[model samples]
Target: MSDFLQTRVGAALKDAALAAVITLLLASIMVGLRTKTEQGGLVIVGQWGLVAWMVGVVFVGRLAMSLLIWRGNNPVANAMNAMLPKQDTVSKIGKLVGPLLLLFAVTLPFYGNRYVIDMGILVLTYIMLGWGLNIVVGLAGLLDLGYVAFYAVGAYSYALFAQYFDLSFWVCLPLAGILAAFWGMILGFPVLRLRGDYLAIVTLAFGEIIRVVLLNWYEFTGGPDGISRIPRPSFFGLEFTRKNGFADFFGLDYSSMHRIIFLFYLILILALITNFVTMRLRKLPIGRAWEALREDEIACRSLGINTTNTKLTAFALGAMFGGFAGAFFATRQGFISPESFTFMESAIILAIVVLGGLGSQLGVVIASLVMIGGFEVFRDLEDLRMLVFGLLMVGIMIWKPRGIVSSRAPSVFLKEKKSVSGDLVAEGEG
Candidate 1:
């Protein structure tokens, strides 16, 4: 028995040593790849290279320890194995409902105050935009740098319709979505085969094309001055304006603040609907196909997934959401401008998705809040605000390289657990 134990220990040590050596080698390679010589003769490190090296080292170290424990017949391996989360942690409905309810609970009271309501509306707008972008970036795994084009399409669709036909906000909303979706399909068809950085560049160019068209199409889009005095949303037969608002119609005191609050909640509901629909779609077969496609497009094609339809659907869906947000924005602001749907807007929305963490709804929400909220807060700072914002983003990236809300791996077969009802351990275990 003693000799057997010694042999097992010796084997474990050998395995551990091999793993450690391999880990170091990989780390060295990463460092070599990431290291850059500056013009000033200073050594600079690439972010990706540094992240890979650190992660590789940690992974290797963990593997070596595991190997050592296994070879030594150490009972601690059982505990370590148990510490790992189950693969099916997403099956519980409570996991989905709890966080959502919490969000609503925390945000509901702000509806009473005009400033708070406006902020809420802005947050919801970004949330809708982020979710829309998520369909392209998260579900479809298409990197779109020109997502603002769809937004521009939607906004302009509303503005044009309202300006030409005297259409109401409600009437233009669906039309805007339809138009945006149509344009998304148009954009998607041309770049169906493109992926990664190439796709991003093409999308960026497409966005520029759309913006240039808006700029040149002066008679229709109102040129750089944009369309103004676009109507706000009305309830039943009552407009939200001070004279004909619901309060006045109902013989109650009237305030423009009330109208703003109403609009806020309206957009909030719309955003919630958008989020709900997206989450439900994710659980459907199409959603599964999207995940598969995201993981490996080639494998998805091999599995008989219709990549073309998948790509088109993603674009259309994403554009539809953008259209919704755009229409709401036009109504809320009482104006529409090309400046509202620029490349910078696209970059900001994309940044929200990337910074929030790809494929994470909650992450997008938090990221939007941070990015947009920060922007609102920094409005007073003027020129220096942008610099500070960029620094904040850099800091966040350095601290949490994956994102603010990092992408979570999907559960295979496990039931979902609510964070509120169960302890984190229990949630993972179940």
Candidate 2:
């Protein structure tokens, strides 16, 4: 027992020291950049302060992770296990929470502050995007670092057609999704045989290619100036204008809240549709094929599954949902640029999917809320925001390294269904 204690303490200190050194190196350059003053003056300052703060944060984080998370017989895990409900109880809780959340969302427009509603829209957009990417990454085991390419395609498809052809928002919505799916298939074709880091590089290149095209295609995509004044979606044929809109039709006072509310529901419905389709797909043969391929491509082929079509479908479907969210983003913002659909956007969506517990719908929603909503909450902190965000992410990874929903509810069962803990599942075991 004495030797074990000594070993644990020594390991924790070593981890903390390594963390401090690495944080010092990375944050020194990252958080130390020059900044513009309010008076338009430039200052190459704040390096030492940033480095000091980062080092302390990383040291403490690493220590805590080693002591509380990775340590054998951790009390934190013990306490959580004691408190955690059984599978049946969790299902009961979910049934109750789902309806209540939907109810709150439905009435939020009437009672929620504008800022709150806006955050809701942002969260839901990422939720949809995360769900879309979940198909490729979680189900099909594709590490696409450039999923934002489809998002850009969808946004640009909607914007260009709406501007030049004068199409209504409704008319262009599905078209945008289809176009994005087509691009997904096109991109998927070249990288079908690749996997892991090589596949990631290819996908990243694809994303950058799309962004560059949008950047340099000045004649078509407006180049760096971006597309602006993109029209918002109307209620059926009724525009949401103050004079003759939903409010006017319903004889209610017209507030801009109505517009925001519409967009909220629009994304909500779209997200729900994405969730529903994904859930339904999970029960189908192709869906099983996805999981099979994700686990072992060679085994999947041995079982007579066509790996190529499965990957393409996953990519296409994932891209389609991303396109849907992108179209909604364009309509909501009334403007979009290549900047809006950067690689960082893809990273965030991928993060949400992974952090939410790959292949879990409810996990994606919770992750979006925590991540996007947490960012909004910490927006005023500025310099400290990323620090807090990184800590939270690392903490969660340590606490539940697989994700919040690390237990997989099996899609098939012989006698009764059982929740399979991620700890028991090997890599690609799903």
Q: Which candidate gets the maximum TM-score versus the true structure?
A: 2
lDDT of each residue in 1-430, candidate 2, tens digit only? 6575478787798779988998888887888665757666776776688779889988999999888876659888687677878878977786687678778777877888999999999999998999999999888888889999999998899999999999988889999999999999999898878878889889999999999999999999999999999998899887887897888899998888888889999999999999999999988898888877877889888888888899999999999998988889999999998889788988999899899888888788889999999999989999999999899999999878988776766777899887777776433422
What TM-score does model 1 achieve against the real structure? 0.72
Cα lDDT tens digits for candidate 1, 1-430: 6565467555555555566566557666665446567787867564556655565666666566656555335667777667756634533542585487547735665544666667777887898899899878877788888988888888888878988999988889999999999999988898867877788899999999998888888988888888998877888768766676688888888877767777777887788788888888888888878766776777888989998899889889999999888888888887877778788999999999888877778778878888997789788999999899889899988866666655354534468632221111110000
Error of 1 at 401 (Å): 1.7
Residue pairs of candidate 2 with colliding backbone atoms: none
Off by over 4 Å in 2: 1-97, 424-430
lDDT of 2: 0.87
Worst 10 residues of 2 by lDDT: 421-430
Query: What's the TM for model 2?
Result: 0.83
lDDT of 1 at 107: 69
Clashes of each: 6, 0
Candidate 2 residue 219 C-alpha distance from true site, Å? 1.0
Clashing pairs in 1: 88-414, 90-416, 91-415, 91-416, 92-415, 92-416
Q: Pick the candidate with the highest lDDT.
A: 2
